[model samples]
Target: MSDTTHAPRAILADDERLMREQLRSRIAEVWPELQIVAEAKNGLEAVELTREHKPDLVFLDIRMPGLTGVEAARQIAQLPEDDEWAVPEIVFITAYDQYAVEAFEQGACDYVLKPAERDRLLVTVERIKKRLAQRSGEAEPDGPSNGTLQQLLHSLSARVNPGGAPKYLQWIQASVGQTIQMIPVEDVLFFISDEKYTRVQTPTVEALIRKPIKELVDELDPALFWQIHRSTLVNVKSINGISRDFRGRQLVGVKGLDEKLEVSRSYTHLFKGM
Candidate 1:
């Protein structure tokens, strides 16, 4: 007889009941060996369930009411570094694909886009199984848990508006003469639209790129960049501050750059605290 003693325990979390149900059905159909022990309607409930059951895996939503999914994951990661509780593997479920890169950077086991598909879920489950096996013999991973959570929060904050914050750009690539240059994300100072293309201004020079201002807004790091106008996205670090002009219009000044970009009335709220 085979020993059936080590199947992984799992939990599912999502704000939508229909989504959770669909995910549960898909998991049952595709990966029957993984056992789901609990389900939650929000991040808070998910955290509570994690604490209560100490499951081996958690399917977390990126956005949730009360406590955001990232916040809940942070709390769970803070659980005492003890042998009694095994660290759960987190798999993010999000509506937007812009966060996929950041999610991977933060060490998420995998991510599933909304309106979940069977093939993707299967792949995610496979990844989870691999991670769980690798961690089975170890204590927590070597890196700081706080750092991981912080990176994830920063990435998500750029994607969503919690309290009238600016939305981040989805993706950015620059054109320099004949060669298309992919801007090092950290070096970007701001983005400005000019006719048919958007111009990316870094600390050193500016380059033109073919991306819509609106779509790029979803990809930028929120804490680092702000959309002060429909045509511009200014880096928070580069911004000296905001000042009002003669016509009572807001204009933002960058530290090294001489250009003064306009802040539209529609997006003025993003500059409130700064």
Candidate 2:
């Protein structure tokens, strides 16, 4: 039996109002023992609230108006070890799928897709309970290592042809310089974030698309492609393997792609038990 007297503290951060409401409502319904201490619209506010409240858990969004969740997490990690702030477990909430693997690699406790399912949320809360129990006697808080997280993200993002009805991609036609090109999602090796737009990578050539990574995630099939990083998405079939660099950061090698994509530590859980 678990102790019910002590409730876990949490914070929710998301740019969308309705999504936040949905998450809060679901958390209340399924894991009422978790007390939400604060809410924020972006990573900057989330960072501030984390310092002030020092909650046990945080549900952070990957991309926000200011300071991405990944960046904010990096900053939070730099805080002095002697501070009152304990290492907060992170659960990233996003509509975008590409960052799912990356989120796990970054030491996020879990990744909850936008419009999170009740069953899934319940599982996440249960995991948190188990973690808290394991650390009950420890003085220095233990968190997931950045390396393990990156590997997990790579594996999770590599899940191909997830069970479901076939979801087709919407054809996109765009103008690149003087050439107008039409591309199909099937041919794309991945999508790379380019400032305001996403660059679609194909086997033979790369083209700049007007859609942001968020929009591309919705259009791309989850079974075929995954967002492994906030700035990068790759086709599962295109992935060659994941390797560790001298700096200890995980880099994903893709077939027919020359550049190695970075897989952050927060999103690594996606690769576990694979």
Candidate 3:
């Protein structure tokens, strides 16, 4: 029996509308068994959608606004463990020359060039199918190790931009009822979005800012803050542990907070072992 009787789900991310459509079409043709669950226009949206869908694979455009494919892939690969779900296999899509594509293959990473020629994409599809088959009955899914992928990102980063790593927001200025206060990013426990403002909480104080969670995601470092819900981002350092409620939903306990943050079904992959 073929292990892939159930179609594998995937996400496609590209900044260009036509590129996204063309890639989707090519994938459908050569890998019709792949069910595309989500599509994203930018890297940040790609990361968000990936978290929500937890698809079997992702095809990321190397260069996109907010976060590049490399950056998004890093975050997706590093998501908190959920033994129930495996991290998606990542295949980069780029417009780089044939030499760069060859280098990617040499590194044991899969990639599809721009416009996604049929023959080239078929090879990638077959490779992924074989890997998925190998992973079917294993305790852990087969894919590139996180460390190896991280190293790959470092090597490819220079090709994308020979510049410095992205810098996240350092401080947040919010209102505490009547007073405006400056909260250091390091001191924050979490940020929860309301109708008009986002609540900024610390061990000692709670403040409100007009910025939404979407905007905060762009500013905060993904290494520091993790989005547990669409409207919530919690500090990794502040997470005490995870617990399950009556309905089997996951909740995050913070170091100094009375209220536990709920983890949505889409984001449950963030707390795997718990």
Question: Best candidate, TM-score-wise?
Answer: 3
Task: Between candidates 1 and 3, name the one with more favorable lDDT.
Answer: 3
Model 1 alpha-carbon drift over 4 Å, by segment:
1-5, 138-150, 161-274
Q: So what's the TM-score on candidate 2?
A: 0.50
lDDT of 2 by residue, 141-227 (tens): 455764554454344333321353333453444445545455666788888887866787788867776667786676577888878
TM values, all candidates: 0.53, 0.50, 0.55
Tell me which of candidates 2 and 3 scores higher on lDDT.
3
lDDT: which candidate is best? 3
Error of 1 at 55 (Å): 0.7
Ordered by TM-score, highest first, the candidates read 3, 1, 2
lDDT of each: 0.72, 0.68, 0.79
- lDDT for 271 in candidate 3 is 78
Each model's number of backbone clashes?
11, 24, 2
* Residue 51 lDDT, candidate 2, scale 0-100: 83
Winner on TM-score (2 vs 3): 3
